[model samples]
Target: MKLNKVTLAVGILLATAGGAAQAQAQPVQNIVLVHGAFVGGAGWRPVYDQLTHDGYNVTLVQEPLTSFSQDVAATRRVIEQQNGPVILVGHSYGGAIISEAGNDSKVTGLVYIAAHALDNGETEASNGKKYPNSAHPFIKSGDGYLTIAPEYYHSDFAADLPAAQADFEAHAQMPTNAAVFTANIPHPAWKSKPSWYMVAKADKIISPDLERMYARRARSHMVEIAGASHSVYQSHPDDVAKLIEQAAQNAQP
Candidate 1:
């Protein structure tokens, strides 16, 4: 009877190990989308719709853009709410938030769309100076907030988008606190987790060369969209969604 008891215990231990391995091998299905500055979560509607239609569980985080820590906290809250391992995707300034928040244990991978992938001791502002884009002249500061000039918004941000749509985006643009750009990243998740990047070749807000550098540093799977704008996620939803789907398909548990 003692030998039988020992055998049963050994079997139980093996079964538990197998279960843990199975969980680790499972493909990631949960997705959390973070939007960049000068815009709100509404901009992710196109990508969200496509992903949902493809049978993926996707959630969008609405950042207040009040401060860097706040944005990271908001993203972490959404990631924690996921039922399983997640693929975190961020656009533009949203990239910086994910680089910080993607350190979550549940995050399986990260996706950056025309976004910043900052390194240690680097802030978005400091990184931008490394490869300046054409939109700087259009940035106007008031009090402590920043926004693009309405007239140049169409040209600088969404040149590939329809004029009317671009105009509407400019009018409804979200104002981000200028101080948010200066916050340094304590830890960038790309250092540990796998990453994927999409570059908008025509992006006037963040230089495409800068995007390439970020991808190279992270060893990310990189794709370039020709003539795409800073609003590539919005203007070319299908392409952005395709790359995200690729990340989801390839992300490890």
Candidate 2:
């Protein structure tokens, strides 16, 4: 009888092992990367490649800087195309997009990289008011859009990058309509989901102190990297990729 009991236990163990193996074989997680205003989805290529190489399904959403609703719609479309829960990542203005998009049932986690994570009843303009240092003077509000004057792209936006690269990015900048900046987010996903944050200590456009405030408000796992600018993802893709991976793991069932 003891022998029979032992044999039954062994069979059960085998079955459990097989089940676990099957679960592992399935796609573990999905990641949707959103770029902030002024940049296209192309900016996310490096990070996308790194995440894909590490076995995560990833998508980069190109936001239409024309309006807040437009950006959210673009992101939601990408989320709908994903197969499973997503670790939604947003940078700069993209963070505002994720704040609303992360509310989707499929979004399992959020990672804000030097990005705004505003709560409900908050607008990007309102959040910026608290910060004293406006590093980028090029930002002008007119014609219903907010734009960075090309001259400030290097010193304010991409200070860490080489002059040529910064110039190229400046040329590619897509101005976001002023309405998007002032529009208040109705629902903030971070309130319900797990969140992580990376503060770029040397960020000129967005004050690092404000980043700390946002991280604190979200109760996020915050990591500070010195000597990094607003384009922290471009300057430190590996670190950004690792943070996303950690968020994904934490979101796993």
**Which candidate number has the best TM-score?**
2
Candidate 1 residue pairs in clash (backbone atoms < 3 Å):
none
Question: In model 2, where do residues sit more than 4 Å from their true spots?
Answer: 2-28, 139-142
Cα lDDT of model 1 overall? 0.91
Candidate 2 positional error at 205, Å: 1.4
Off by over 4 Å in 1: 1-26, 136-141
Tell me the number of clashing residue pairs for each predicted model.
0, 2
Quantify all predictions' global Cα lDDT against the true fold: 0.91, 0.87
lDDT of 2: 0.87
Compose the digit string of candidate 1's lDDT tens values, residues 1-253: 9999999999999999999988767667899999999899998999999999999999999999989999999999999899988999999999999999999999989999999999888877887788888885646466788899999999999999899999999999889988888888878999999999999999999999999999999999999999999999998999998999888888887
Window of ten residues with lowest summed lDDT in model 1? 134-143
